[model samples]
Target chain A: MKLGFLVDLNLCMGCKGCEVACKVENEVPLSSWRLRVKYIDIGTFPDSSRNFTPLRCNHCENAPCERICPVSALHYLENGIVNVDSARCIGCAGCMMACPYGAIYMDPETNTADKCTYCAHRIESGMMPACVVACPVEANIFGDIEDDSSYISRYIMEHQGGVQVRKPEKHTNPKHFYVGGGNQTLNPLAHQRIEGYGLFNNITHLKHVGDPHHGILDRFLAPFAAHKAVDNKSFMDFEQKKADSHDKSHENEGGH
Target chain B: MVEHGINATNAVVTMDAALPGIIWGWMITLNMWAKSIGTGVVLISAFLLYRHKKESMPSIRWIMPLISFVALNVFLLFTLVDLHQPLRMVNIFFHPHWTSAITVGAWMASLFTGLITLLLAIGLLDAYPDCARHNEIAKTVRANSELYEKFYPFVVFLAIPVTLYTAVIMAESSARELWQAPTELMQMLLAAFMAGSAALVMVSDKWSQEVRKDLALVLAMAVFFSFVMYMGEYFFSFKSAEAEVTLEYVHSGGEYNVQFWMAMVLGFIAPFFLAVSTMKSDNKTILRFAAILALIGLYLAKDVWLKIPQMLPLS
Candidate 1:
């Protein structure tokens, strides 16, 4: 009984209903996400398209988080859902390092590691995940992938070779699948990221807040080498120059 | 203000970013650095005891466990403080999961500390039996030289695992391609040797010149191999794209460029030269200075190595 999740990129309209539903159902705190929609723009201007990729835990068959966890806080249920026992978690963040997909987050309130469980709580009560129920276009398909008659299993069959999973080379064997999204949409490195564009723009330091050595570390490292914050100018400047040149080429062509 | 919407001109507008900032930070770096010293001292002291029994036995017995005990405590303290749920650490021992490197490391480290504590007691009692003249157990332990010998080997054996287990934990980390288990394990071993020898150099004031030369040689060899491993990885990390990307943090003009080079020069280059010089000159001051620099540089190198891989966006 392998539970799975499938997102049809073609059907998703970036409504953000599922994102809201997940937070509400799970009571996720601010600045954290159990599930998220990534908006990646593909191609150049005049031929560009936007892809809404709903990202969440893959609940891998060989989950690294489950293995790296010091206390078995992350364990696989009989139904294949990777569940978390916050009570048992020592909050080592070892799971955070082990999860390739970046699905896990340190819950600010509980001070424990947390992530998408495919809504195991609801599933046990015989209810679908809130994201599935909230999605207006029915883009989210959830069911037993092992059961041939299941909707998710049938969807996988229909899509066949077209289905894609992120970072398959990592060999996590993610249960989450995507249909109709190309490499540009699935691969984060394939696209250009602008500074000050996303959540907490230019605030990559938010990650440091969780460290006990936050302020002291800054002071301690200050004398040694004085490493600057991540150089956003390197990549962002290159991207902006390319975009400007692209616009110039388009204008020159139009003038002709 | 550029919002979460696509501009059609730009390549992407990532609406929701899941970039967890440096999950493990300086505390973790300190943990590894201290552990290396703790384990390295035991390993080196054991070798010295076996090889230079006459010169090293009296001092090394008490000093080795004492140094290790202090450093190991610092390692354990930071490890606890770094955890978001420090109180639940007992779950590691109470509800033991043998698979997790962290759980295994915790148990091994605890047992290692315990053994070191026992060794310290025995060494102190053996060296100064008058301190515990009234205590029967202390007197009994002081007389039992065979028991001390038996326990010493166990501490030596346990030190290797306690030092190497962190590499397994790092290697097991998902998507962190930089921390390959084999390479990391090798690096950890080298770090132990480097740290152990450097630490012994600091306390070898009462030891013979030959023993000092031996410690210097060990420091030089460890530094040489450790430097070679770092350079190899830095130059040849292109085999894996993820590893290449992670190495970008230390590449020329990259974020950690200056610090990485600083670590190389201080930890390996200077130490190597000074250690080699001490072999011929028998200069205690230069040897001690080299040891100090090596320890400091090791901490910096570890800090950079740990922080760089995490800087790469996992999302």
Candidate 2:
């Protein structure tokens, strides 16, 4: 049975308990983490409210990362857990740009990339992923999608499942099934920085748009940019305008 | 007062598109700074080479250490851009989406760093041109000197693009105005070539006054062209809504104002003066200082250009 994680944003209280639990359980370096809680503070000051959503890897069906590594450092196990073999990673930082979700980060200790693995270590030992286990709000749901008895499966079937996926049309089919009204639709621009631990405490977004032609030029530059390999997977969906339009409506609708 | 509200609203809409552009433009800043260092190194080398032309090539045994030390500072500059987890720097690789500028920049920087490191090692062991004939570090360096000659050009070429990649990434982004230059690629190319020539001249030995003057004149001309191109791009970005917001931010004297001024003086004006001063006296020191100033200013401009555009997005 293929494993997967279903994060019901509706239940996530922005408590960051999952963020804390993931760190302590993983012995993650004090400065970084595998899982993070992100909040989007929309509207101007005073009228603005915080929109919190716990974020992690979706164990993408069409994983962009596995396609780009110069060496086969990251792999998706048969059970469908996305994992990294640290020995193979060369500290290249190639995969960070491939992920639309900004889910992965380079581990400073090993100088290799690190992101949520659905807790393969704990899962093999018969324990749930740390975030799933420590989720005081029970907002995170993890299980095998194929088995009808699996909670995630039952949950997906019972409720209208949504997700914070890349423009599925862009081809990275994120398996992180989102619940209704969670993540005011998927918008990376609105994805602000996680606060606390020094510097700006507000949930700020990225520095300004560095490349306006990103939606186009990035694709053109990809082949010529670097030596990183690419998987010629068919990306059946890539409508930047559509995603942008949908994002506009989604944010206008207020907190999901 | 009215503009602030307009800016805040606009920021909300384009935030997604702009963030990556900002991240990638940083590489451009580093490229600029590195070039500045390169200019200083070249001018100094040029002066020394000119003075000691008749003597055996004076051993710049100290160059190896200086390169390493300067490189260390350059390394730290890249590390300064992070927010939450600086150690997770490699995450850029594990999550590769080819479209992400930061990811692409990370790869370029890694490759560039690797090459620089190898060059450093080769230089340290003193293994350039004559290793095969004499079997000594110095001889190897002399024998393999050809190898380094080849290596230098290639690295120069790669470094140049990596330098411009920053600006190109910026020029295309909808986020910041300064980056959207219609002529950015060409502008950067002109600057890199001019700087490259200056670097070569400063570091080369056995050259004549006529040769030095010719190279200096060419570089000055290149600087003039680059300035024109940049001005054009600067104004081009100011005509749009998103771009205009960013353009206004630059004029607002955000954190980058002083940096921009420094770049103008050091990168453009100072070198111009230094190069011109050589016409008055045959002194090498003034020329060296000019070369250093020009290089520093070029880097300053690159950094300010990349970073200042970013400060405008509402917090």
Candidate 3:
């Protein structure tokens, strides 16, 4: 039925309710998350604006993770939900490298790759995803986009040309769509200056802990970590200009 | 350099951005290393066997098969240990994914191992004709030397594919530009030959002048290929910002600068000179040292090649 998510950025309040709800419902470890809210700050002080984008698995049509998986541990269901068969997983982590969205996480507990299953178990029981139900602003919409009568289908039709999918250039043909002003938050490369504060600070921990050469070994292996010096300033500036032009064109198309 | 400061003060914050880390770690690297050595030994031995009617090098004739067999087993062992569900490896045979390079590689490795083991048994039977009188399989193999000789070429053909499969696994990862580069397979092939030849020369005590010359030629080709691949990757500018950053990290005295330079100098430059010099002198120790250096350098090169690509944040 091609079940998908349509996150409306206009209504989101950066409350982080979905993030917490997802964690509680999934029983995800404190060190990892199935979903997260990205905060993007645009412009300077007085002219500044903020955008909150909910990030999760795109459940792509051309799933690279599924293709790259050596043991066929990551597979797609009939409804198009890409799910990981933990029992079959070899913990090779090939899927983690293949996923362009960074949706998958290596669960050290299970020693297997894990990610959002679109709450497939809950959906099979005829319940909405926990994140959608708990979203205070009702910003997280989930339904069968293929079904014309579904809310997601109507929402997509209503938004029409305004819908945005992150990294469309990746050609994953992501099922997750964002409506309204999510340009800044959707493009990860667009974040000019990132402050590792709040939940974002965990990114640093993730980088360290996820590293194969962390702990005592890092003393000897630290020099090989030089690729960490990614100069994204110029790239971010370019992306910011591109996003601005996109916003300008949308503004010309009339207000949301 | 892009400053990744911890203080949030006034900037945007991404809670779940992609982090830098190795997805496939040392286990995969070791597996590839062992597989290359195993395959290369058999490949070179097969070349020698086809060209020379008699056993020109008595030591290499018996040693090469034994080494190839042991190395192949090591490759298999590492691969199994790396799996989360080691028992589930059999699932690949039952539920094969034809599209997956890893699936093909697994099958290729299995076939290569089986063929090499059989070939080793045949070689052992031939060497100790008295042992063949006792065992039926050994007797059949020893009696059917002509048949085994005919199949040697086919085994050699399988060895090349099995060796290249290691490289193809990395190159198939479309998400990592550093791996997906067209020259990755070529680089890997060259390195494998270099490593394999170096290892062969290190263990073999007595070899004919022609055998030494052949090994020298192989080492030279390896160095030449490395130069071409490195220049192509290092000199050419990448279109993608992420790719450019990754290439810069590899070449621009970044974190892996020491390892990279070490690989170039020790693995390629030094070995090239040592191998070339062997043509004028019959110094076995020089060749052995060169082989040891090349082996170490190739491993370092692979370590850099595998680790840096993963360190680049994909999301």
Candidate 4:
């Protein structure tokens, strides 16, 4: 059976109950985390919206981290769960570098690569993941996706139109799915400008979008941009109208 | 701003990506530098012997093997000490993975160390062949000098890959965009050769005009390659947003800008000019100054290379 996660962003309250539960269940170190909440602030000022996305290992079918491990420390179990055999790990940190999601962490205490295992031990005894059970608002859902009658499968089918996964361009075929919000929440790099300090006092900021200095070639290309500006406005207006029509069509379908 | 509503002032985007803790720090960098120098010395010494024949440079006949043996051991020692489980290092040999760069690197290092030790033993026996009359092992070692001379070129060939492997391991990491550049391997290889040659020039008491001139040329090539690699990364930007963010973090007046600029000026530009200016000079003091500067600059460059990439969050 292919196990999967269905996270509903609309239901997440940013209370971090899952984060606390995962730490308590797994006995994760004080400095490390198996699951964490990522707060994304979209737009600016009064027009802005905050999306609290719970981030963890997606357990991708085509996992880059598994392939890049120099030793067989990271491997896939039969149930599609990515397991880390800490006993065999040399703490080379290669898996940490290969993971696009940054799920794996080099645990200094254990001197091995550590990450979420989808609470494999609990699942073996026919129990839900600690994070899934502890979520107060029932935002986190996990079940065998292959079974059409399963909660995760039924929920995904019902909300199939709104479901999305992180970094679809990476072609990892992630088992974890998100409903509500869109690329702004799913794509880690979508927010071009952001500032914050993590729990560990690590600061995050945005990079310069373009080259600071314009060269002679830029000046030469400026006149063509003047012609395109007028056309760009009409093109955007047309796109807005098209989006309005699409929304209306979906509304009619829902009424029926 | 609406009262009680979350705004930019109150909002903070906290990232949960794996941050660079205390692992793979200065110790790893120093270990890599030492390994390159160790391998490089053996390769350069082999070239000198091949070119001038064993009898021509009588001083280097003893000096080269001794220095290389010591350096290789130091390299091996540092590598062992850096491991969290030093005893588990043997696991790399027993359960080897061909796809893993570290596994292959361990094998390469072992082979090079064995060859250098054998070569050094042969050198010591040949230097005092009179001792062979009294000792059986000395006789066997003296007899094997010619055999090892033939094997010396093969060891030198292995040295080149060993030097390149150090950089290849880092470049293989797909997530760190700064380390993923093709030029990184080339840059490290050239820097190793330069550091090795410069270090040799510093320690050697006597240097012939032709030997000095040849080293000057090697130094120039190293500087040129450094410039090419730096420019390649600067101009031909990687398409990913993560790559751009990392590039800007390191290059565009971020915290690492000072260190990056220092590395560029001192490591590449200063050494390039110094080596060029002292090319025709017979003054040993002037040459040593240039050599020392090259070593310092190269070390600083390596420091910046290892540290700056981790500053950017991968996720």
In order, what fnat does every candidate score? 0.65, 0.06, 0.43, 0.29
Highest-TM-score candidate: 1
Among these predictions, the greatest lDDT belongs to 1
Candidate 3 Cα errors over 4 Å, as ranges: A181-184, A192-256, B1-20, B50-53, B130-147
| Candidate 1 wrongly placed segments (more than 4 Å) | A199-205, A208-256, B1-11, B143-145
Interface RMSD of each: 4.2, 11.3, 5.6, 11.3
Write candidate 3's Cα lDDT for B102-212 as tens digits. 889899889878877777877777777787498777777777776556767787888877888766767557667666545777776776688678767866577676776
What is the Å distance of residue A102 in model 2 from its true position? 4.3
Score candidate 3 by DockQ.
Answer: 0.22
Sort all candidates by lDDT, best to worst. Answer: 1, 3, 4, 2
Clashes of each: 2, 56, 1, 0
Q: Tens-digit lDDT track for model 1 on A179-234?
A: 99887677765566666766445543354333222233342333365443322243
List runs of model 4 lying over 4 Å from the truth.
A144-163, A168-173, A181-183, A191-256, B1-18, B21-23, B46-51, B128-139, B235-238
Q: DockQ for each candidate?
A: 0.32, 0.06, 0.22, 0.13
* Stretch of 10 with least lDDT, candidate 2 chain B: B10-19
Give the winner by lDDT: 3 or 4.
3
Predicted complex 2: CAPRI docking category: incorrect
- Full candidate order by TM-score, most accurate first: 1, 3, 4, 2
In CAPRI terms, model 1 is classed as: acceptable
